[model samples]
Target: MHVPDGFINTPVSVAAGVAAAAAVAVSLRGARRELDERTAPLAGLVAAFIFAVQMLNFPVAAGTSGHLLGGALAAILVGPYTGVLCVSVVLLMQGILFADGGLTALGVNISVMGVVTVVTAYAIFRGLLKVLPPGRRTVTAAAFAGALLSVPAAATAFTGIYALGGTTDVAIGKVFTAMVGVHVLIGIGEAAITAATVGAVIAVRPDLVHGARGLAAPLKLRVDGRLVDAPAAAAPVPAAARSTRKVWATGLVTALVLAGFVSFYASASPDGLEKVAADKGIDQKAEEHAAAGSPLADYSVKDVDDARLSGGLAGVIGVGATVAVGSGIFWTVRRRRTDEPAAAEPSAA
Candidate 1:
């Protein structure tokens, strides 16, 4: 959920900003180890896709809706570090260009939405994969579970943060219950989207999925009644996986379609956080967004009277801008990945 300004006090907001800054710094370093030629470019696409999907909020309950948080989906498709950066990029774009999330509460949103979600989901995903069967099925299953958990985890983190620095005097226990309860329903949608997206990619180009890397079991042979690992490397990379342009183009097209057209049918009700805040009085002190005067404020292109055209144009612009910013950041990180550990193909992930 995108925390707006005035929800938390100045001190706590500043503290969250510092924490977010440190996490982003560390993630930048970690992403250097995660990104390379092939996967580095996909980072942008992942961010854009997340931005696009988030616009299509599905109804979760009466007067409540939910959208993709993208942490698990991004982490399963890319790496955790890069996934953090991807969500952060989307937050930044939404804050500045769309005036959706507030500039003052940027850190809070990044901390709860980006870092908390990515960390929680990636941990669960890897843990599940370690115990389950090693294949695309395992990856998809882990993704679904990871995504399901991450939403509530993020809501819990917000509750904790609010307990410490909430601007209002509302009962934190009630907020906690409402936030977690509503987000639990949202998590189901998140799980389905994550599993389906990851499954689709794995079906065509499992090699492109960072979480599925080395998932193929090592070859084994029976010699003298003793099973031993084969000396040969694993399976060969399919031609589809080797060529990055086709997949990249396909992802961009899909993102465009989702944001530009499909978003029109998305539920118009408030999201989980907004509903909870309004219900619990946490939004009593909420302040106007600093960028509210921007031309693209509220995700509607300025000077466009047609609701459909304005929203669609704004969505397209958001996707294009997010991809550009995310690609530049990831490309810079990939260039500085010279000191990483050796690998068969650094970019293949």
Candidate 2:
């Protein structure tokens, strides 16, 4: 959830900020191992896709809606470290450009929505993959389960944080109950989206999906009447399939359509956190976003009379900006991975 300003006290907010910064720093290092020439660009596309899908909030309850948190989806598509970075990028863009999440609470949002979700979901996803039968179906199923649980996990984390630093004096039990209960319904939507997206990617380019890596059963060879595990033959790739260009172009187009047009039909009700805050009086101390005056504030373009057009343009801009920033970050990380060897070697022998 996008925690706005004034919800958490200054000290806790700062603590959360430190925690989020630490998480991002660790992820940057871990991402070096995960990012390669092919995956680096796909990582950026994944971020843009998450940004687009987040705009299409589906109705969860009478007054509450939910959207893709993207933790499990990103982790399954790319890797856990990169997934955290992806969500963080989206949150940052939304905060500074769209005035959606509060700048002061950026750390809180990243901790709950980015770090917690990614860690929880990836752990569960990998754990499931360990026990379940190896197959694309199992991978998708595990992704669904991981995504389903991640939302409530995030809610629980937020509840704990609020218990420590909540601005208003609300019953902690009621807040927790309401937050978890509604988010359970929201989790169903998250599960479906994560599963479907993961399934689709696995179907097209399983090679590109980090979670699906090594999913193919090893080649079995019969030697001396005993079947032995053998190295799987490298499958020949056509000149076209080798490049990530097709996948990247397709994903970008899909993101553009979802944000630019499909988001218009998304539910208008407040999301899970907003609804809970309003209902429990937790929002009493909520402050206005610092970027409320920005041209793209509130996901609408300034001076744009047409509601549909304004929102569409804002969404498109958000997708473009997120992709650009995410790609730059990932490209830098990938370069670090490549440069490590040279830096380690002695120069001028």
Candidate 3:
């Protein structure tokens, strides 16, 4: 959920800001290991895709709707460290450009949405994959379950944060119940989206999906009366080796279709957090977004009378900007990894 300003007090918000800063710092270092020529490019696409899908909010309850949190999906498609950075990038863009999430509450949103969801979802996903059959189906299933749990986990984190720093005097227990309850329904939608997206990529390019990397089962052969593992095949051609130009073109086109075309049909209802806040008085002290006056505030272009055209243009701009920013960060991380000296080969003697 995009926490607005004044929901949390100054001290707690500042503390969360420090925590968010530390989390990003750690993610940057961890990403060095996660980013590769293949994964680095895919990481940017994952961020752009997340941004696009989040625009399509599905109805969850009578008045509440839910959208892709992207942590679980990103972590499954890429890696957890890079996933954190991905969601953070989307949050940054939405805050600064769209004026959706508040600038003051950026840290809170990152802490609850970015850090908490990625860590929890990745842990559950890895754990399940370890026990389940090593196949694409199992990996996809784990992704679904991981995504289902992550939403409620994030809601729980927010409840705790609010308990400590909530501006209003609402009952902590009631808040927790409502938040987790509504988000549980939202989690179902999250699970379906995560599973479908991860499954689709794994079907075509399992190599690009970090969680599915080692899940491919080895082929077995029957030699005489005994079964033996077949010799592993040589490494497949890299995406860059075959056709970087084509892949980039296809990815950009898909992103444009989703954001520029499909987003026009997204639900207009308030999302899970907004509904809960309004019902539970969490927004009693909520302050206006600093960028409320921005041209793109509320995901509409300034002075655009046509609702469809205004929202469509905003979505396209958002997708383009998110991809650009995400690719730049990931490319930097990948370049840094490449620049580091390789360890000396072991002595043959």
Q: Which candidate is the best by TM-score?
A: 2
Best by lDDT: 2
Clashes of each: 0, 0, 0
- Per-residue error for 27 in candidate 3, Å, reads 0.3
- Give the runs in model 3 whose Cα sits over 4 Å from its true position: 219-247, 342-349
| True-structure lDDT of candidate 1 | 0.93
Summarize candidate 3's per-residue lDDT along 1-349 as a digit string, tens digits: 8999989999999999999999999999999999887778778878888898899989898978899999999888879999999999999999999988879889999999999999999999999988887898999999999999999999999999999999999999989999999999999999999999888877776767889886787768999989899996698665446544455567777877888888888778899889989988989999999999989898899999998899889989998899899999999998887777543446558
RMSD of each: 5.5, 3.5, 3.6
lDDT of 3: 0.89
User: Judged by lDDT relative to the true structure, which candidate is superior, 1 or 2?
Assistant: 2
What is the alpha-carbon lDDT for the whole of candidate 2?
0.93
For residues 93-168, could you state the per-residue lDDT of candidate 1 as single tens digits? 9999988877989999999999999999999999999899887789999999999999999999999999999999
Query: How many backbone collisions does model 1 have?
Result: 0
- C-alpha lDDT values of all predictions: 0.93, 0.93, 0.89
Ranking of all predicted structures according to TM-score, beginning with the best and ending with the worst: 2, 3, 1
Model 2: how large is the Cα RMSD against the reference? 3.5
Report the lDDT tens digits of candidate 2 across residue range 85-203.
99999999999999888898999999999988899999999999999999999999999999999999999999999999999999999999999999899999999999999999888
Our model 3 lands, by Cα RMSD against the true structure, at 3.6
